[model samples]
Target: MLSVHTSPLHQPGTGDAGGMNVYMVQLSRALAELGVEVDLFTRCRGEARPRWADLGPGIRLRHLEAGPRAPLPKEDMPALVVPFSLALLKEERRYDLVHSHYWLSGQAGRIAAVGWRVPLVHTAHTLARVKNAALADGDTPEPPSRIRGEHQVVGSADRLIANSGDEARALRELYGADAGRTEIVRPGVDLRTFVPGRGRAAARAALGLPVDAFVPLYAGRIQPLKGPDVMVRAVAELLREAPELRRRTIVPVVGGNSGAGPRGDAWELARELGVSDVLRHFPPVPPAELARWYRAADVLMVPSRSESFGLVALEAQACGTPVLASAVGGLPTAVRDGLTGMLVHGNDPVEYARWLRWFAEHPQAGAVMGRAAVGHARSMSWQTAAARTLDVYRDVLCAERSGPGMNEAGATARSCLADASLLEGREGRNSTLAALLS
Candidate 1:
């Protein structure tokens, strides 16, 4: 697996580390559980760490030296792709396929796959075109070079994995990805780690949150694209609509500064809106700790302007908390609208604030929704995702073995896939989820 831009070792919700980091780590571990030996390759950032380390029984993380020993911006990463690819090629071991996460890794995977004569499977995570189309106010657009690079990766990849049907359609419409090559492999949450272990009251007491407080949590990188400001604005607007609920409301913003540069201004926006007292900020926490925060909250706020998939939403739901997310990207699929959570149509603070008021006004309804969310989350898991991903890998390898004509290769791949009865059985429950949504 090629993950050139960010390391799985890094703590998520900080810098460039977000859902993609979680996706790689969880998926690799699940694949390993299925008896697949996995090697995760990333560009080395710190000099103190070893060259490679065993993540688990069958998973290994190898750090390849490419650029400076310190962290470099994503823009500088393109230059290091060739160096990274060269270092990756120096590996003595052989592999069946090269699976790359993100376009930066896709560039390196493109090189490594050719060098090893293997099929290249790429996951975009987030497309430049999709993000650029939904840029937040005063947010920088994705660079032209990135758009061009995505186009190249789309053309060269043997298979493309999308987090949702929305993402698959985006690939086909925006980047001209071949419909036959593109596959929907939903991302999954860690079911074991993120569960409603002791229910909401216990979680609230543990997290030091008031038992009766109306807590709407925002957990992700503090970036413009994530619409953290929109969350703050909604909080302010919510207070305006229901001033009596102010004493019982607490909004926890859990994450660190991230994006192109320093973008941690959610509190400043709150201060400007005169609702600083209602908001509490914290640095990013691990998955286990994050799950506690999710359990403590009444609802998770995923107000991202452009999210390929809202993994945080699923995590919150798994912890028995409903989500109040923007109806964009894969969030509609992640959140069940009125069933599990409410999906606001746009990034408008008024709509988000209205939902916040609804939760504050009808606390019992939120609890009922939270119960339904747990059941919704249980239907999707990392094990299910890994099983489906294994199917994709098998399909790709079979096609590669067939050689030349796609007509013969497609038939061969499908015929072989039919033999995997166990995987096919799970396929019935998740026609919408090719495996499970991340």
Candidate 2:
């Protein structure tokens, strides 16, 4: 697995990290349980750390030195593609298939797959074309370079993995991706970690939140696309409409700022909208602790202008917390409207504010929705998602073994993957991984 630009080791809901980090970490662990060895490679951005480390029983994180040991903007990544691809080439020989997480890695993965004669699978966590179409206020449109890069990756990859049917359709319509190679694999949530019935009272006490407050939680990277400012504006609107609830209401916006959000900033927006008195800002917490926050919430607010998939909505639902999300991208699929949560259309603060007011008034209806949410979340799990993903990998490998897909170098890739399934009990050091780490 390639995750260039951002590392899975980084905390989600901060900086350049978000759902993709969680997706890679949770999916890798789930895949490991199914007896698949996963070596996730990303650009090294820190000093004093080894190039590779065993994350767990079957998962390893390998950092390749492609540039300076510091974070770089997404725009600067294009220049590092050759160096990143060269770094990947050193270890590409040992991999059966290359699965890249984002467009930056797709640049490297495409080169490595060709050099190693392995199948390449690319998952664009967010597409430039899709995002540019729904730019938030004071947000810049995605550059033409990124759109071109995505087109190249879409055309070059053996398989294009989309997190939702919505994403699959976008791939076809926006990038002209081959329908035959497109696969829809829903991103999974950690069921065991985000279990239901943690109790709202207990959660509030543990998290130091007001016990009587009607708390609406906004959790994720506080970016314009994520609409944290929209969340703030909605909270202000709700408070203004119902001043009586102001003393008993709290809007906890949890996450670090990024992109246009860093410039138009949520904290500044909250103050400008006169919601600072009722709003609480906190850094992103760990997953286990985040589940507690979800439990304590009257509802989770996802006002994202664009989302490829709504991982947090599922997470909040898994914690028996109803969500009020913008009906854009995968939010419609993540939330079962009138069942688990309410899906508001457009990026309007007024609509979201109306829903928040409704939840505050109808406590019984909110509880009923929360219970239904838990039931829906139970039916989806990381294990199930991993199993389905493994099926995709196996199908590709099997197709290659039988079909006339191999041409000289393809024979080597076929042999490597066909025998990999038999390596469940085996363990060894790969020279490339060892050298890079050392």
Candidate 3:
């Protein structure tokens, strides 16, 4: 079985709990269920010492200390990779393949693969081009060096795993990755946790919201990239056009925290628009609480300009809630227009207001769409995603070992063993490491 490393597996309060964290946790658990021995490596935060969680008989989460013992932002964690990789390589275990998530992990995976002579597979959840295009207003500043590093990782990876067809196309167009080297594998959601049920009253009661109110949900991180500002403006516009909506006790429940972003300013904007009474912003809730929010809401809104795969849309759909998302990035792949949900054109306030009003007047249509949304959600699961990822690993391994005069695979295995020998005398060597070291 292939061993994967998805370092920096999100702190509980971080805004990156959307797709990357969801993918890592669910995919690892699903792979284990398929009889694959999976070891998930992540950074140890604060006093949260390195510990192992036995997710299943075949899966184990091995926390590795990287950078500071405390949590660091994603953009600032690349320098910690060299030391982290060195520590990981010193361990005595031979993996058939090493799969990395995101560019930071890709860099470590590539170095580890070379040193260990294992095939490396990379999944860049979001590309530099998409991020830059979405955050072009100087609201979010990403380092130029990080962008260059991401480009290098994409070009050098043995195989690139794109989350959607659109992402695969972007890779081919922007990074010049060979079409043969790229594969499209959509992300999966946990249907069990996000299923439809009697959650509206329970969720609203817990949040101290009126049960009779019509709620519109915007779950995930609160940031400019997410375009919460646009959603606020749209809600303000909707209330202005139809005073009945305000009288009907309509509210926009935004789930997530500020997290060093424009969340404070977003609140200020809501006040400026005089829609503060209707905008209910709160810190992110647990998945169980989120499920209730999904059921409690009349609609889910995703106005993000860039998203590799919108997991929130899938989650909302699974809860039988219709969505209204931006027609950008992987959102188009996630939300079907007029089927699972409506697709608004841009971040324009007027356009969003129009859609909100239409849905308000056409409740029956929204309910029908929500039913279709649930059916659509059933087809996407973490088990399916894990199976697809395993196929990619198999294909890459086969290609690496195929053809005459290609002793590269054999040579690489020998080199990995040779490297393991140097750490034989190290303390605290486990059976897995000792056997490989010998």
Put down candidate 3 lDDT per residue, 1-438, tens digits, no spaces: 222223335532245555677777788888888878887776665545446767668777666666777656666676676656666776677788778887777766766666677677888887877788778254766677667767766766778899899899989988887788788888888898998886557767776778767677778777778888888889999999988889664565545653444344668888899988887666666777778888888789898878898999999999989999998878888888889998987789889888888888887788898899999988988999889988988888887777342234334444555555544543523333333222
Question: What are the root-mean-square deviations of the candidates from the true structure over C-alphas?
Answer: 9.0, 6.2, 5.0
Candidate 3: pairs in clash: none
Of the candidates numbered 1 and 2, which has the greater TM-score value? 1
- What's the candidate order when arranged by decreasing lDDT? 1, 2, 3
List the candidates' TM-scores in order.
Answer: 0.92, 0.91, 0.88
Name the 10 consecutive residues with the lowest summed lDDT in model 2.
Answer: 429-438
Indicate the worst ten consecutive residues by lDDT in candidate 1.
429-438
Where in model 3 is the C-alpha error above 4 Å?
1-13, 199-208, 258-264, 403-438
Q: Tell me the TM-score of model 2.
A: 0.91
lDDT of 1 by residue, 386-405 (tens): 99999989888987888752
lDDT of 1: 0.86
| Tens-digit lDDT string for candidate 2 (127-202) | 9999999997668898998888888788777788899999999999999988878899988899988976548999
Order the candidates by TM-score, highest first — what do you get? 1, 2, 3
RMSD of 1: 9.0
